[model samples]
Target: MTGPDRTPPPGDPARDGDAGAAGRFADFGPPRRVDGGLKARSTRGAIGVSWWSRRFLEVLESFALGTRLTRGRSYARKGQVLRLDVTPGRVEATVQGSRAEPYRVGIELPVFPAALWERVERDLAAQAFFSARLLAGDLPAELEEVFADAGAPLFPSGVAELTQRCSCPDFAVPCKHLAATFYLLAEAFDADPFQLLHWRGRGRAELLDRLRALRAGATDPAGATDPAGTPEPSGPDTGAPDAAFAGPTPDVEPVPAAGAARVLAGLPAIPLDEAVDRFWLPPVPLPDRPPTLATGPELLLRQLGAPAPAIGGPGLLERLRRAYRSFGRS
Candidate 1:
């Protein structure tokens, strides 16, 4: 029975329904503008640096709500987002819109339970590549595959896995503010991918310590304890000498008191600056012979175990000793 131009008259029930629809449309009006907000470092091009970060964005874009991200992108580029705080399984943020006060936003993901994380830590410890890189504080690019193999996907698999909300009037689930926060998050992952792991209910230090413990236990299956329950020595023990064996013993030289007393008295007196420069600066070619204890700083330290007030502060004397320690090692 309905046809074009057969519209409900004003003040009618049907007319009221049309007014409600118009009011809902008005809610999507121009988003509030933000000035001096936190701008995305990337003014143009993609927001993420690594493949994982880019993939994160691609996943967001794939959602039915993906097209809404365009407005989010604009907000992000313009730096409309005010503050973003990320924690394990949760993110809280604020985005400045066309209003005097900023809109609050939140995003949540499920934290992997302790049991699942234990399995992940054990399996990751077993992979030499994963362990080596992780110990070095670098997350492997292929780490996602490891999570998949362990039956837990690190990134959100779909919109169902993520819960997003905004205080803005926009009925769109994410609204543009959520999008801006997401773009900023991708940049965060680029800087430190370990954040992704941290978000999954484990922190960098905790995970590293656990991996170290697992490795140590695997290497020492006996539990490394003595009958008394005290920890046994970690280093290898050199068994007692063979009673029947004969080996050449190193010759030991006896110290001559008078000679040692005369050693420091022998060197010619030189200006303090000249002596210090000679000690610090290396020669074009290193000398063929090493400086003996009697001729170098060792003699000074031995004579003055408690250094003079002038040279003692800030461990200046200790540093001099360290300088000589490097000689043999180098």
Candidate 2:
């Protein structure tokens, strides 16, 4: 005699938990069409173009959601996600599923505390390379390492770090609707890694501003006042020469103190009244010819690598290369 029928009844949501039940789910059917939805830039293969975006997608795929991720990728490509908003500690989206009304999905991640971000900003500002690249709107590859060194990882370490929710009736933690949002979100990250940082509780402008302040403070420590709000005693007028030069010139190294003194001593001493007529003029005659232009106007592009996929990817680099060459010629 057959044991008591153990099969779950038809249309039972419990079936979603069974092995390979995702393939048999009726709601897994085609999602409703969406108009003017935020479609992923990548049509096939992987969704993310940048290393950081790929790292995020890699962490999500590691969860082994299996067919759910696949269906979500399909939804992303089909533009089934109507809206996606990423804010501090959270990502919210509206995804069109097989139902009449769209489903709301949200993915939450831990935000670094202000103290931790201050530490991170200090570390980032300490590294000139990091600060320069960030100011130039490029995410350096070592940026995540800097964040990790600050005791706060730049990306979610695992599934446990993320809290996912969906309005869909599917019993999965990340239903297809949420998965679709993930894929699109990866594309968004690829477009601007700052979005990932913004979701971590610090906006791009704020982070950059903090970095600038930290760098400036490091450069001019004497300008900083004491905790008691007392101004430090002024030093000798060593910077007078710099002030006389109308401020430091870009890419020009400052002269050593001894070297500057030697040069100053070598100068023919003359009365201020006698030198007034030629005081603004150069001590020596200027070079007759200007310096030759550096070759390879596209060198910066080569250093920066490919543009974001959302911004035309390789094609943009090629166009920029041509434009640079044209400008150089002109």
Candidate 3:
């Protein structure tokens, strides 16, 4: 080899071939063109369903792959990501690009061990607010705190906790394909925060069932809670009617409908001054005022007539009463 002192010059054909190949390699990077046009975006601007999900995307953007993540936002909105499937510790997806065949993307997140979930479930069950919300088909905002207290974060905090793979020529860990999938998952999390929990391996049903069991076991016989996580009344379930249901006592004659109608009809043609006085001076008794008007059972019937009942059925009166009571409170 030392005998080959006569080396090829820099402008040799072999050198040119090497240089040209390098130039061509650079040119053949990830596709920048579109095929069959870009998909229509489902959402405008940033993509996310809830604050937590938005936070998720924010964290993702902070990664070194910021540029690719930004580009992926458009792909996410445009529905370029065709399929997204999530399982315990993994997310798999297909994303359409300039190529005829869609790119494959995968993401893997840390799976909370079963033992950790047991500790978390116990902690969640201890917190009435969390248990109540979870039972009512919701993920409490306070869940983050619970996880923090447990010393186990529920969401991935950084790239080290995540594994991303994309079947694209780009060497970036999270290429555009992966980014699109991430955004889609963000929106999914928004619609149902439990989806995030599900991504971590425990589904809403399983978590709820476990919570219910834990709550029941932890509940003292003296202070048990109903299935809804509300404390049961201390006394026996005395099947007696509620005080509100006691009704106008048996001895008190019911106000005849005719009488109520006449009373309503005769609501004095008082001048504005008298009407104002009647309204403002609660202490002073008005002449023809009926007691039933105070409790307002027939208030709806008086205002809306029989038509409401006729159209809404027997339950309508109770609903209307509740509505009127709510309005009064407001």
Q: Residue-wise lDDT of candidate 3 within 24-58, one digit each (tens)? A: 12223334445443342345666665667866775
**Candidate 2 C-alpha lDDT tens digits along 1-330:** 111223245466544343345443444445677889888888888789887888888677766565668778889999999999999999999988877799888899988999999877876776676788889988866677667666787888677888888877766767778889999999998888899999999999999999898777555524337799976645666645433235443433332221123234457778989989999986655423212223367755663567889999999999999999999999
Cα-based lDDT at residue 61, candidate 3: 63
Per-residue lDDT of 79 in model 2: 90
lDDT of 2: 0.74
How far in Å is the alpha carbon of 62 misplaced in model 3?
1.6
lDDT of 1 by residue, 1-330 (tens): 111122234465543443345433332334567667778888886788876677677677655443456668788888888898778998888898765678898888999999889877776665455678889878665566557766788888677788888876656666678888999888877787777787778888899999898665544423257888776654565674532232322221221211112233345677877778587643334323211112343433432344567867538767877777776357
Return the clash pairs for model 1, or none.
32-97, 32-98
Please provide TM-scores, in order, for all candidate models, with all chains considered together: 0.59, 0.62, 0.56
What TM-score does prediction 2 earn? Answer: 0.62
Q: Candidate 2 — which pairs collide?
A: none
TM-score of 1: 0.59
lDDT of 2 at 63: 63
User: Model 1: how far is 163 from its true place, Å?
Assistant: 0.8
What TM-score does model 3 achieve against the real structure? 0.56
The model with the greatest TM-score is 2
lDDT of 3 at 330: 79
